[model samples]
Structures are given as structure tokens and as C-alpha cells.
Target: MPKVIDHDQRRKEVVDVTWQLIVEGGIEAATMREIASRAGFANGALKHYFSGKDQIIKGAYERSLNNLGDRLAAHTAGKRGIEALEMFMRFTLPIDQEDATAARVLLSFWERCAFSPEIHGGYDEHLDSWKAGYLQYLAEGRADGDVLTPTPDEQLVDEIIMLNIGATVVRVVSPDHLNAHVLEAQVTDFIARLRRAE
Candidate 1:
């Protein structure tokens, strides 16, 4: 019998290789030929799994977002009020090697979003999810009397999103300037300012 191939596994492997290339040399480095070589696929084999480079990039981007979402869910599970919000914000920061790696993959795709409506739409969807979660935790904190800030939940959500996105970019570009300690301290202080007096 001819050899049987697991298409799903091969596609995932291709995406993983693409992610590594992007992290190493930005999106430009993840060329189809290079990805196929790194992924142990023939030059044209990637077409079997992905339509082209954009599709592979989209796959890698989606995978990165999915992984981040999973981590956020795990870290915030059973936590509520300020605790949940803090965990959500901190995890979005590139405070560690893993987070930093994810940031690299995400940032590589950030530019492409401007040129691709599909990718841009996907990003918006994930961002909306993040905003909703922030709003939920903020409302919960208010109900529990943990949050005392006069700022509207929607405004706070926007601030938090901007803060995290800015921090992530800074951390990726200048890790020395925004070291893990500094990033953590910034997030802690931001959350602290919104908490009610004990």
C-alpha cells in the first residue's frame, strides 16, 4: 500500500514552522519554500494544506490567538473581580519568554492585517472577545464592591486594551526598557488604583 499521510497533522506542522520563521525574521522570512523546507515538506506540498502564504500566515496567527486565549482562560479560571481582570491584563503582556514568543508571532501578522480584510476581521473578532471579558470582570468587580473607580466600564476596557497593546509592542521592541518587573508593576498599579479601600 502507498504511504498514508495525516493531512491535519501535516498542516499543523506547517503552521508551527511558519510561526517559528516569523518569530526569527518577521513575516517576510516565512516564505513558502522556506516553510516547506523547515516543515519537511516538498516545496509544493504546502499547497495541499494551505491555499498560499496568506492562508498559512492566517493559520499561524489564529493558532497564536487560540493559545493566548487558552492561557487567559486557565489563569483566570475561578478568579473574579480585580483578580480576574489583573490576570487577563498580565497574561496579555510579554512578561516572560512564552508570552514574548507569542507577541512576536502576533506582531509579525499585525502589519498584514492592514492589507487583508479577512485577517483584519479575525483580529477584530478576537479583540471584541477580549473587550467583552474585560467588561464582564469590571462589572463583576463593581457588583462585589471590589472596584470603586468612577470610570465607566467601557472606558476602562478601552484603556486596559490600549495599555496592554502598547506594552506588548514596547516589550517586544525594547525588552530592556520594559522588563518583566516593570511591566508587572505597571499592571499591578493600574489595577490597584481601581480597587476599593479594604
Candidate 2:
């Protein structure tokens, strides 16, 4: 019998290799030839799994988003109101090496998004999911009397999202300036300010 191949597994392996390349050297480093070689596949083998480099990059980007989502779920499980929101925000930050690696890969995709409609669409989808989650948590906090901010939930979501993105960039680009401890303190203060005053 001819050798059997696990297409999905091969595709995932290709994406993983590509992700590492991008993380180490930005998106430019994830060339098709390099990915295939790194993945132990013959030249042009990637075409079987992805249309081209763009799709592979998209796969890596989606994987990063999925990883973060899983982390968020685990961190926020059984939590509610301010607690859930804090966990959500904290996990979103690049406070640890793993989170920072994901952030760096995401930043690479952000640059591609300006030129790739598919990547831009994926980015928008991820942002929408995050916004929905933020609104849900904010509503829950309001119901539980944990949040007393007069600001509209939408506005607060925007601020929180901006802060997360900005902080991720700063953390990745200037770790010494915004180290993990500083990030944790900043998030704590931000969340505390959202709660009702005693």
C-alpha cells in the first residue's frame, strides 16, 4: 500500500513551523521554501496544504487567536463580574513569554492585514468576538453591582481593547520599560477604577 498521510496534521505542522519563523524574524521570514524545508517536506509541498504563503500566515494568525481564547476561557472559568473582566484583561496582556510570543506573531499579521483582505477580515472577526465578551462581562458586573462606571459599555470596551493592544506592543517592543509587574499593577488599577467606590 502507498504511504498514508494525515493532511490535517501536516497542515498544522506547516503552520507551526511558519509561526515560529514569523516569531523569530517577522512575516518576511516565513517564505514558502523555508516553511517546507523546516517542515521536512519537499519544495512546493505546502501548496497541497495551503494555497500560498498568505493562507499559511492566516492559519498561524488564527492559531494564535485560538490559543489566547483558550487561555482566556481557562483563566476566567467560573469567575464573574469584575473578576472575569480582570482575568480577561490580564491574559490579553503580554505579561509572560508565551503571551509575548503570541503578541509578536500577531503584530506581524497586523502589518500584513493592511495588504491582505483575508487577514483583515480575520482580525475584524477576532476583535468582534473580544468586544462581545467584554460587553457580556460588563453587563454581568453591572447586574452584580461590581461595576459602577457611568461610561457606556461600548466605550469602556473600546478603551479596554485599545489599552490591551497598546500595552502588548509596548511590552513586546520595550520589555524593560513595561515589565510584567508593571503591567499587572496597571491592569489592577484599571480594573479597580471600574468598580464601585466603597
Candidate 3:
């Protein structure tokens, strides 16, 4: 037999290398040649996996979003209402090295989204998904009487999503200003302000 390859695994490996490059040195560093070399593939081999660097970048970004979604799903499983929502938000905070790396990679992609319509479209889809998730959680909290901000459902959903994204970006850029405790406190206060008065 010649050689069997797990195409999905190979593509993921390439994407991992691309993410490493971006996390270490921004999107500009993730050239196809560098990605192939770092991924232990010939230059031409990367083309077989991805048409070009842009495709690789997009793949890496989508991978990041998928990873985040997986983690959030894990955290939110078997939980509902405010507890699940809080858990999901906590996972997004960049308190540790792994989260910081994720935040950096995501921020780097945000810049690319400005110019790449493909990336922008993917980002829009990812963002829309997040907003929808938030809406679900918000509705759950309302049903359970855990949320009482009196804000419009759509408005609350948008605010929550914006707050999480803004905090992630700020934590990535100035972690010292938003330490783990600070992040927790910020979220806690935000959530508390949504509670109905006794």
C-alpha cells in the first residue's frame, strides 16, 4: 500500500501550525511556506491542503471558533439559566496562558476581517451564532426569574455579547488591568445588575 493519510487530521495540523504562527507573530507571520515547514510538510503539500495562505488563515480562524464553541459547550452542559451563561462567559476570559493565546489569535483575526471579505463573512457568522446563544441563555434566565434587567430581550443579548468581546480584547491587550479576579468581578457585577430586586 502507498500511504494512507487522514485528510481531516492533516488539515487540522496545518491549521494548528498557522494558529501558532499567528499567536506568536500575528497573521502576517503565517505564510504558507512557514506553515508547511512548521507543520513538517513540503511547500507544495500545503497547497494540496489549502489553496493558499488566505484559506489557511480562514481555516485557523474557524478552528479557533470551533474550539471555543466546544469548550463553551462542555462548560454549559447539564447546566441552564444564569449558571450556564456565567460559565460560558468565564470561559471566554483570558486569565491563563491558553485563554490569552486564544484571545491574541482572535484579535489578530479581527484585523484581517477588516480587509478579507471571506474572513469578515465567517466572523459575522460566528458572531451571529454567539448572539443567538446569548439570546437563548437570556430567555432561559428570564423564564427562571433570574434575570430582571427589564431591557429588551434583543438589546440584552447584544449587550452581553458586546461586553464579552470587549472584555476579551481588553484582557488580551492589557491583562494587568483586567486580572482574573477583576474579570470575574466585572462579570459578576454585570450579571447582578440584571437580577430583579427582592
Candidate 4:
């Protein structure tokens, strides 16, 4: 019998290789052939799991988002409101490697969207999903009195989401060049503004 490798594991392995390539040599290094070579798989192996560059791009986007989502879900378990809010914020930090990798790859994919409308839509959906996580934290805070802001105007939430993502790009690619702590504090300040009055 041929090797019975678990498809999911191989997919994760390829993605993990692609993630490293992106961080080390930019997204261009993640070209199918390069990624396949780095992963020790045939040039076409990626196709078995993805349709083409666009699909891999979308899969990378999904993979990166899931990395954060899975962590946020774990952090929020059995927690509520600000507690969950704090945990969610921590996952966005660049202090951790997987989080950093996810952030870097995500921004790379965002840039890729400029060339492909399909990836553009996928990127938007991925972003919206993240915003939903933040919204969940904000809504939970609102219900628990931790969010004192007046229903958090849509623009503000959008700004927060954009700002965090922007900062993530900076922190991921150039840690020595940017301070993750400053961005974290910026987010914390916003969250604090949402807390109930004394």
C-alpha cells in the first residue's frame, strides 16, 4: 500500500512551509513550485489540495485567519465580556510566532488581492469574519457594562479593525522596526473607553 498520509496533515504541512517562505522571502517565494520544493513535495502536490495560485492564496488567507480564530475561540471559552476582550486582543499581538506568521501572511494575501478580484472577495470575507470576532467581544462587553461607549458607532469599529490590521503588518514584518506594545496599548485604550463609568 502507498503511504496513507492524512490529507489534512499534508495540507497543513504545505501551508506551514508556505508561511515560512513568505516570512523569509516575501510572498513571491511561495510560488507553487517553490513552496512544493521547500515542502519536499512534487511541484503539483499543492494542486491536489488547492486549485491554483488563487486557491492557494485563498487557502493561505483562510489558514491564517483560522490560526487566529482558533486561538480566540480557545481564549474566550467560559469567559465573557472584557475578559474575552483582553484574550482576543492578546492573540493579535506579535509577541507569539504563530500569531505573527498569521498576521504577516494575511497582509501578504491582502496585497495579492490587488491583482485578483476573486482573492479580493475572499480577503473581504476573511476580514469581515475577524471583525465579527471583535464585534462579539464588543457586544458582550456592552451587555456586561464593560462597554460604556454609546453602542460603538460602526465607523469606530471599522477603524479599530483597520488599525489593528495595519499595526499587525508593521509588527509582523519588522518587529525591531515597530512596537507591538504600543499598538496593543492603543487597542486597550479603546477597549477601556468602552468600560462602564466608575
Residue 193 in model 3: shift from native, Å? Answer: 1.0
Checking candidate 4 for backbone clashes, the offending pairs are 148-194
For candidate 3, write residues 85-198 as lDDT tens digits.
Answer: 888778877766788888878888888888888668888887888778878888899899898887787887777778777877887777777778877887788788779553
User: How does each model score on lDDT?
Assistant: 0.87, 0.88, 0.82, 0.73
| Model 1 bad stretches (over 4 Å) | 196-198
How well does each candidate superpose onto the true structure, as a TM-score? 0.94, 0.95, 0.90, 0.82
- Candidate 2 structure quality by residue, lDDT tens digits, 30-64: 88889999999999878888997789999999899
Quick one: best lDDT, which candidate?
A: 2
TM-score winner, 3 or 4: 3
RMSD per candidate (Å) reads 1.8, 1.5, 1.9, 2.8
Model 4 per-residue lDDT at 66: 73
Q: For candidate 1, give the lDDT.
A: 0.87
What TM-score, to 2 decimals, does candidate 4 have? 0.82
| lDDT (tens digit, per residue) of candidate 4 on 1-198 | 888888888887777777778777768888888888987888677788766777666666777777777777887899887787677666766646666767778778878889998789876776687678677777777787667776554655687677777677777667776665676677677677677453
Q: Indicate whether candidate 2 or candidate 3 has the larger TM-score.
A: 2
Best of the two (2, 3) by lDDT:
2
